[model samples]
Target: MLYDAIRFQAFHQDMRIAMIGVKGVPAAMTTGGGIERHVEQLAPRLAGLGHEVTVYVRHYANPRGTKRWNGCTLVTLPTIRRKYLEAIVHVFLSTLHALRQKYDIIHYHGVGPSTLSWIPRVFAPRCRVVITFHSRDQFHEKWNIIARAYLAWGEWTAVRFPHATIAVSHVIQQFCIKLFGVKPFFIPNGVEIPSASIGSDRMKTLGLEPGRYFLGLGRLIPHKAFDDAIRAFRNVPTAMSLAIAGAPGYDMRYAEELYALAELDPRVRLLGFRTGEDLQQLLAHCYAYVCPSRSEGLSIAVLEAMSHGKVVLMSNIPENLELIDHSGMSYEVGNIQDLTRLFTFAAREPALLRERGERARHIVKLHFSWDSIVRQTDSVYESLKA
Candidate 1:
């Protein structure tokens, strides 16, 4: 009573934050991907900075209405999940739920769900809406004509509606500027650089011998061009085997084609999804990590490989170029011949592989650490609050 009679003071503190996307924390963690990894890292780190964070996710597998983990609250909303296109419906419902919450800032990921952005303008006009355009997914040849048009429209809406936009790579920023007339701030993905460790024991558990394999890590999608890696590896020295690590989800047909392509060839092994220590072990001990993707937006798999100090042979997309140039190591996109030559070169000169791996590690340390990325993202959040 004495203190209350003395004085009254206002307090300025960190803002309440909401991250809106299709996936929640534990689901995202269990199913590893770029967007999931981004949320898993950024949300908790933002919470640690004294900001109240609640992530809004689409209700897919979660029976629970809400859950909490690692100091972050996860709110799931009801939505349809018939096809991939239904993600928009899910995101829209999730955004509506987010708008009902007392959040100072709302951050949305991806451009598939255009209607989701309207929530901030319609329901919570005062709250700042920040959208991170993960990638321009329609560019891939996999999409049919109508689907591409729909996605393009969604992208347009996503760029136009947000208070601010974030592009995950320089390539993506340029694409958004060119296609949607939106100039987005660039924030590349982050990776945790690993300490030196012999991953032979872990590899042995996966039925692979130490130092006897090359690794390809990513979803078995058509654009990833896993078949190109297999064709290229035909030119590699006999001793080295190729291990493709990723789940078959969007492109089961592509997976079937890959299996058919490598039917009799024991050199290529499709080791479907491997996470945790299994993935880390593969990255640590592989002769080299190959990313044969025709298109990318700062690949998390490549960054993971670099983090483990592995030599990377990637396609010559601008995103890959941004990470590693042609001088030390790289191959032209969709060029089986160039990839074959690079593979042969890596097999013949083992010392060069080690040298390039060290260089890759150095690059990751300088540019891709999670701490630096989190700080950069925090600065972005601060800018919105201001």
Candidate 2:
């Protein structure tokens, strides 16, 4: 709907944009994460706007070959697929490749990849370099001390090297100002409301009774804290099931722990990696959506849930609090007892939860329109040329 409101001629002609950092477009659609989803949504739309868009994707990730996607070109590069080396290796190669291209805007995603953003700044002096600070990656628990230190350094490079910077949330913009003494442009992530009906076929296959399960979606990472949500659900004395829909992200031990926990309770269902219609149906028909993250940069999962008109129960982190006010309930971050009590209250009072769900939808519709995000991002690219 947002696309319908914008004029196609607003985009500048013959402008070239090279997006590095994400795995790829169609590949990102399969592996559901914030950065991945952001690329999948924005890249094709940017190509549709008459810009020459080229994305550097990993060879293994983009299995469908290097075919052009929706007018955008995909350049597959090689990378060692190990957890620590994957991003570093891929980004290094991608940055080197981007330096040789005739691009107007070279945009990088995440602070880690932004560490190399200065490559284009020094080599391709005529091309403007841009980086989107998606999150405070240094705070993620999975990284080692050395990697954490490097990510912190990456944050420093991101603010200084780029011609213009974009922060996905206001919290991240404030973070840039407080830490780096620079204020970056704020352009939050956006989500489309699902148009598909809540079909009962997938529900029956998953042994789910429509609206009887609480939904948790996103990558199964330690920082996400889905374990706390599971523990909290155990305390709630209800017949409702807890369905977690996600895939593990290189943390085998954590995944093992989660699988073990799921086995303890028959009510807990570990629905690994639901996408497309299955994912949309789960979001469309759920008792409530739970997010127990310790850190976030405008969670796309939370936004998608809100867009689906589902009640959200999240932690009191600054990023989550920005999107949810009295419209949804929150507990102390990492406090199991507090979250447990909140879940019990929500399960018991379904009517009250539905009221909040309506408010959540209204909040997303007013604030996080994808059309507005695209237009704002286009303006940022145009300003660089000016």
Candidate 3:
């Protein structure tokens, strides 16, 4: 029987909660990027609320087996392979394992591996199931026509099964309504300001002179539009360098294209991946941060830049526009000319950059603080019990 803390406060006080996804919690606790960061932060907070939390992860490359951290348990299941195909197998096996365990609530992330949702509806009908759509995968240009259709179908199924769904941004919520006719609750990603020393000496170590470069940080994927940022940097009158930092995971060919482009121009530097203080240091000394993603569901990278108090020039997508609509910040999603103009403008007026950067930090502190986000998420969990 499931524990009902509010109903039987004295007798059954601990609620068992399970978080389901290809990779979650402990596996995400240390290394992965944004989604991993979400699980790493959220699971511990939920556990702190006196809920017994279990994060289900795919046994891809993880060799740690099962472990406990932050008062939460991580359960890994065997899968077929380490690639995308393995995600499907992982969902099926994880769901089967979850069904055997007694959980009151099941929170699933991403829609790609729809098998997880499909099983929960059939096998764990009594459990309150919540799904969070991190982003619309179909918008990525890397997907072929057939792959796009397949992902769309998976998203449709996953959204339809959940009792309530979460969309990380208003743009994503609208996309859910349009594509799946599901009105998911919106909960934007949040960030915590790093300590002052995090990224202080990044410029010195990278051999970059102060105020001589701009920064672009994210996964090296085509959809991120790194090429567009490079083209815009060419138009700047000052001898400005652009630092591209991220891991090239999805498309090596596209990464090769970016590398070739950088080779032609000495001004562009591609740093494969930087973590810890290195990433912070790079952001700390950057003249400005640029985000040229063609589509985004509230970019964590953009938020990180804002947390560092750097002026950001982002694409005109609704996700970015929702956060930044200031004087110095301007939009250029598809038009290279507009991006060039924005870069030129930033180079000409240094004071405007500082002003915009300060404003960006202020806005983030007001709306995107992690404390407020954890409270909202806690409310969501409490709602399930009610």
lDDT of 2: 0.87
Per-residue lDDT tens digits for candidate 2, residues 7-57, read: 445455557999889977763354547887888888888887778999888
The sequence of per-residue lDDT tens digits that candidate 1 reaches over residues 163-245 is 88888899889988898787988888988877676456777667677777889987777888999999888766677789998
TM-score of each prediction = 0.90, 0.96, 0.89
- Give the winner by TM-score: 1 or 2: 2
Q: In model 2, state the lDDT of residue 337.
A: 97
Report the Cα lDDT for candidate 3.
Answer: 0.77
The runs of at least 3 residues in candidate 2 whose Cα sits more than 4 Å from the true structure, single-residue gaps closed, are 1-11, 27-30
Task: Select the stronger candidate by lDDT from 1 and 2.
Answer: 2
Best by TM-score: 2
**Model 2: how far residue 239 lies from native, Å:** 0.5
Q: lDDT scores for all predictions? A: 0.77, 0.87, 0.77
Ranking by TM-score: 2, 1, 3
Taking the candidates one at a time, how many backbone clashes does each contain?
A: 0, 0, 2
- Model 2 residue 379 lDDT score: 83
Model 1, residue 317: distance off in Å is 0.9
RMSD of 2: 2.1
lDDT of 3 by residue, 1-386 (tens): 24544543453345788887646554222235567667777788778867898887766535677578789888878776544566667767777888878788788877775535867777877787888788777788888887788778867866787777888888878878897677888888887786775535567667676677889987788899999988777767778889998877555888888898888778899988887667778887889999999977777888888888888988888888877858237665878889988888888888878888888888888888876776677667667767
The TM-score, computed over Cα atoms with residue i paired to residue i, of candidate 1 is 0.90
